[model samples]
Target: MMHGLAETTTGALTLEHIGRRFGETLALDDVSFSIRHGEIICLVGQSGCGKSSLLRIIAGVDTADSGRVLLGKTEVAGPDRFVEPEERNIGFVFQDYALFPHLTVEENVAFGLKKLPRHEARERAAAVIARIGIETLARRYPHMLSGGEQQRVALARALAPKPRILLMDEPFSNLDRGLRERVREETTATLRALGTTVIMVTHDPEEALSAGDRVVLMQKGRIVQIATGYEIYDRPNSLYAAEFFCPLNKLPGVYRNGRVETALGAFPAGLNLPEGGQALACIRPQAFRLAQPGEGMSARVVRCSFLGEIEQLAIKVEGVEGTLHMRTTERIEVKPGDDVRLVIEPGGVLAFPQA
Candidate 1:
């Protein structure tokens, strides 16, 4: 939980000890979590980490090998209980923005509301179209609309039934980067305005951190951590978790007292390692500050490339094991083989026991 972001006391969705396997590979192992009403939770991980498998189980498209899933008072999945996909009232927006080319935008939107009268369904679709600001696209077919328009139609169809919850599996992966950002903003605003409870699955860490109220990070079919973006990025539970978000420079040494010696010189790392105990100091690239030649830790620039507002560089320090990767916005007249210096901020270093 994060301050200023109050989760609903009422459990909107809950997964208890969920497990699934594909042949010899475990897809999900003992995964459990609770979601509050109107909350947006992102399930994020690397490829083949079982994020999609978990989403399928939650959507009722696939069955879990173990444990239970509940939405409000409805027992959606359990050892002895199972609910069909349609009956669960979960709206899924697929990665491809699955829309019907044969149907008009209005017809597509109305498809999910078939339980309502034909007239009532059209009315609901029209209202949702207006809400999506795509009323003008109501009569257009999927091919007649742009990528963003088609996505809006898909989203409109999903929301037409006023589902208990919405499940989006990388819904924005299809569009171009620019269009994706715009559509994401629009979709997020609409979901929040309608107070919809959403559980989305994506492999992109940036998307998970930017759009989720809480991020559920998965690794090898197991949840490593679940927290707000800030907490997960800054206070990772493990080295694996830390490296998942960004690259880290590892410095190996032995710890004695409270410091870990590294190529960059020793700084305080509160690890209580006995003398001669192994330790590894981890530092993020952005933590390095540029300094005048010989004024700070010495290094030789091996590579530099301008990246819009910042420059990406690879530098080699005398005692560091590998080339250090860093990104900085500071203007520096340096190229390959140029001597450079950098200083690590006080809190930039984190020491852990050598694995």
Candidate 2:
């Protein structure tokens, strides 16, 4: 509720060899990571990738099958002990908001502060509601408010108790596109202002890249990579990690010297591979740009589609099977069966060992 209520640097969290299982399925496989006192990290992956399960384990709602979780040197979930969710001082905002339809916004926010006196809880709720600029919605019920309003109320309720660590499970998935962006920006700013330690799970790659200070990418119940958004996007550790952030155009070739030699052209092998070993060049659509007819790789435009701010071109290049897609904002006057030359842009290509 206050500007610096969560400013204390006492809520550092660490997870060591954490594992979870649902019957025969392995949900999390030796997952491990840590969070700073007031840092914001985003957990991103495909559905059932154990992102939500990991969050539940950290929140003490679900038990870890193996390993331990430490919050400021205290083991919250481990072999020797297990702390209940209420005692962990962790706040969770579920995917659906989970606001009670029967209660008004004010009452819902005050719900978490029941430990305080009734009057004091109401006062705290009011202050948070006003702080989020949602005072007018205090008396309105959940069913009467828009999706964005409900999301704000959910965030207010979570922040009401000033929990040491806040876990949000797809908190912005329910809002429309424009509103989701606006609310995400506002919520991120609010949380940063409060200096709250946050772990937010998101399925959207763009959201994860833009919102998080660092992105933790998980796959098949294991962490594939953990790095800042830019590092993860530009320097992915594996082919899976590269494909996760964006659709990639894979060019099969052989690694020679420091480049992968394909029929079309040679591209820098970002990763190390044995000489003459098979390598796959993972190039994003934006990496292919239009060049003068004879200056770059020769290609024929198969199709072009206007997509609002940008245009998508499906082009055919010699020695490359199928059509390679390219996206650009330039207004290229091209159509099906048109001749074109394309150049590979620097820094948009990632090389990996061919599977």
Candidate 3:
């Protein structure tokens, strides 16, 4: 067992080489990470990417076939020792809220305080309800509350017991776009104010970027990259990781003389690339610019749409067969059949090895 002081200094949760298999499918493969006190981490990936499996293993809802889970220096899940979920003192907030229809907001928050004295439980429940800014809805049943209200009640209930760590499984997935954003901001602020450690699973890139202190991107039951939101967006390690976070315009070309020669034009490679090797270059829509007729690569406008803040244009190059979309702030004086020139900005190109 690890020493108590060392554990306190490191974190409250640790997973070492965790792996879980279900018949022919491998859910989690060699997963390892740690979460410290009063920190929030977000796990992000496509569906069936082992994020939920890792959370379940940590919560003790599912056992790992191989590996050890340590909560505060105590081996919660291992070959010889298995600690029950309740004994681990970890709270979980599910996607569906999971509020009991029969219970009021106040009663639901008080549910987990059963071990405490009656008066103390009531006082704690009241405190949490007020902290969540839902004291007015204390008497409302789950069925009567709106989606956002129920979400707050569920969170209040989970935090009422003051668990060492909190796990949220796509908690904002059910709400509408507007409500989801509001609830996310509110919940994140609440957690930070209380100095609560949290691990949340999400498929939405925006949610992962805005809500997490660090974002962990997973693929094929393995972590592909772990970094801050800005790092993940600006410096993606792999093509898959880049495509996962935003729309990538993949241009097929060859790298030569420290530059990528594509159908559009030759552009300097921002990062190192193998000389004279075939690669796929990634460019965001905002990276391209409209140029004069003869100055840049010739292309014909295919379509145009007006977004709120900017205009989206689809242009087809003479040499490049498919349509390429670009976003620009300035409104272009062009139509669907209008011919235009495409200029790729320097240092905007990201090249990866061609598969």
Candidate 4:
């Protein structure tokens, strides 16, 4: 299990059999993953899924009851030994951009560098401030800055420490949607320029997919899938993995003879299923293409809504229990009760067999 020097650029982090619990709740369960050096990975999951707990464990701020955490070649935490947070070469950015209220922006960024000589600390702070383009606001207090400006100051402070690994906990949650997008892009660029190995925890699936080089998706207390945005979304390991990225149109059926037959059509299971097992043909909303009458399953349009670039339709297919949602860029001429035909895209049908 030796990753070469190229793979261990900044330093590798390996977690083996990490587990944590709080009274009646299992916060983490046998979590294990390896983070490559200089990689910006997202630890993504819903609330209560242990993403934050895992980040804290990696930073050595929290201890795991059972596991081994290795940073570089050094064992930071294990049953035999534990390293304190200060001893771990980790930098952290809290969700609220925790800046010192009373201290000026420059002083706050230089706070961690105080261990060095006074002259060297001041030089490092000035260099980071200039790099972050926040030198204009150096003397200003936290309250004098806007949300975005304060975030920049916080980032400057984190970068000033020159930590081997940076752990960010929902760093953009406080900003509005528009600002979040802009700030996220800015932060990504900054981190890339610095070549810092980062593991960011986020609850937003879209954000995780877009921001991270690799996305580690979690459910309950363990990882469900880990891959790039396209890989996880296009080749999900299960129905749960598929639905997490986008809305799904589920068509239930029985799996047999290597196929799952549904109201729309039959799809290849691609894997063996239990005999007569309950299965679902999961399709994306954008998968449905309009076909001529008599060519495919006939459906009557019950609802249609026009978005800016795409149109959404709710159609009731014959023998189907619920309205099927479809998105298309083609012009829509049909209204309520208008009969239409629909077909599934070859790439869209995913069959998941349930035990």
Candidate 5:
């Protein structure tokens, strides 16, 4: 519907061997990844995992100790060259929405267009404000705007300049959970309509998985994996990557004849572990479904908790120690001490080499 979606330009962003250090801490280590033009990338990791630090380096706010960053064929940062943040044609939306307190929404949006004529800057500001559907707040100052309104204003200001790339660091984190979800949907739609290339940093896995075209998962200053939401969740590269995105029911087992046999069932060992090696079958909570009596592994419902659309369940199976957590969206008619049968839904089972 929007013509802007087809207006993606050339100039893929490429990072080569980027590394940074702070005192004794290695913040970023040889981090290398490429983003296609107009692609939305989300950097996700735990605190101190270098996601934010990598973003700063890409925006030219923080310099890398080694390696180079290339926009298309032009080098932005390297051993021989360094570009200032403003001159890099990159827009940054900080987590706190850094709007000028003394200026109105329109004025704040127009501040970045200082190089243009006064009328032209005002026109661009008004056009961006209208496009983002926040023109009604043009005359209002930051103090008078709500958290969501301020976030919209910040986005409008960032997009006003029509930069080559946009970087956001947890832009929706300040709002309430419901508001955050709404704003995220709105922002994603707006970015897609404008065909803006974006690199967003988020600590929340749901935000990362939902909003990103591709997710970059990092751990301890190193990149763990890079893939689409489905691939990252279903075909994780490591145990850390698997557990980072969702909770897994790790069942201990032994690898034999290309399968890991656990007390629950046998799962294809996706790893290349030697025969008779220690392995684990990682099953997601939603992987278990209700089965008819005596059809699958027998499990006892230890507890059942209603969680709106999805129900959380603690199940106990014979020959396996500890309670296995399960989640289901179906209106399962069960309670504690009820006998139940659970069948493992195909594709939710993954085998990993035990550490």
Candidate 6:
């Protein structure tokens, strides 16, 4: 579901009932989502999960076997209509940057302005280079520039065209962690300043959370959940979504009489579920707090690992089958084989159907 007032005030780019296939394998399966103008939407998923395929469809680089893509009110792709990539006026920043090695930065940036006179093309390219804060490297070749510099040059080229939309296909995948972080922040700021509509595909969760106005979690070519980072983390709709977003410790539980009974204790079941049915409940490490032996559920510390700021403990309850992972900020004094208690906060349990 779409969130916030921006989605309603501004019309969105819509993909309706999109489906694509490659022989016997399905790349996209009736996937649909909307991205509002001036909003940055991130498509995130595992490898071979149709994230890139969906981006290509939106860019008009590939046609869907069935479905419609609408930009504002215009139908860009559908059963009877298909817009060519060049006609779509969408800027694409590839993973590799794809700059011309032989050409200077200015020449490369001006490649898309072929229709304009040479003087006008150079003028526009110069303006964009200045806007991206890379005017000093106007005469340098791609190989002469650093990874971050080359990325900026590529962005300048894409922004030079003044496209109605910008599509980035894993743009930060090639850079190191430090460079990726800096470039992403700068690029996001640039896009925001221009109020550009952008769709970025990335496998990195941190990047998706930091760069996107909205995160669209995809799986098997279908949209799972579209929400802000906080919403997705706090209230994941399914087990798959929750586990994909972060590490989760799931335990067997039963929903009965409007309550969920687990190893920890019986708690009020907030979600609607059939009574007397077995379900899986998810608890994140941060959701639990350490308690005194008699204050909470009794358990024994099976293992502990120091993770810099926080300490992770693997605890085992006497009757519970699986180990429960817990994280604490303070250095825990407990050791392996030491009996401790785990207090499952009533608000942290997220239960789903067993199937």
Each prediction's TM-score versus the true structure: 0.94, 0.95, 0.94, 0.92, 0.95, 0.92
Q: How close is candidate 1 to the true structure, as a TM-score?
A: 0.94
Clashing pairs in 3: none
In angstroms, the error of model 6 at 29 is 1.3
lDDT-sorted candidate list, best first: 5, 2, 3, 4, 1, 6
Tens-place lDDT per residue, model 4, 1-355, is: 2222222332578888999998888898999888888899999988999999999899887899888888887778888778799888789999999999999999999999878999999999999999888999999999999998988899889889899898999999999899999999999998999998999999998999999999999988899999998899889997888888878888898887888887777888776677688888888889999988688778889999999689999989888888889999998888887888888886887878763
- Candidate lDDT values, in order: 0.86, 0.90, 0.88, 0.87, 0.91, 0.86
State in Å the error of residue 171, model 6: 1.3
**Model 6 TM-score relative to the real fold:** 0.92
Better of 4 and 6 by lDDT: 4
Candidate 4 residue 138 C-alpha distance from true site, Å: 1.8
* Per-residue C-alpha lDDT of model 6 across residues 166-250, encoded as one tens digit per residue: 9999998899998899889999999999999999999988888889998899888888889988787778887877888778778
Better of 3 and 5 by lDDT: 5
* Candidate 1 residue lDDT tens string, 251-298: 897787688887787867766667878998888888899976678888
Show model 5 residue runs off by greater than 4 Å.
1-10
For model 2, residues 1-355, the per-residue Cα lDDT tens digits are 1121222244489888999999999999999888998889999999999999999999998899898888877777788788899998898999999999999999999999989999999899999999888999999999999999999999999999989899999999988899999999999999998899999999999999988999999998999999999999988989888999899988899999899988767887755677899998778999888888579888899999999889999999888899899999999899999988889886788789999
| C-alpha RMSD between model 2 and the true structure | 4.3
Model 6 lDDT-worst window of ten: 1-10
Those runs of model 2 whose alpha carbons end farther than 4 Å from true positions after fitting are 1-11
Using lDDT as the measure, the top candidate is 5
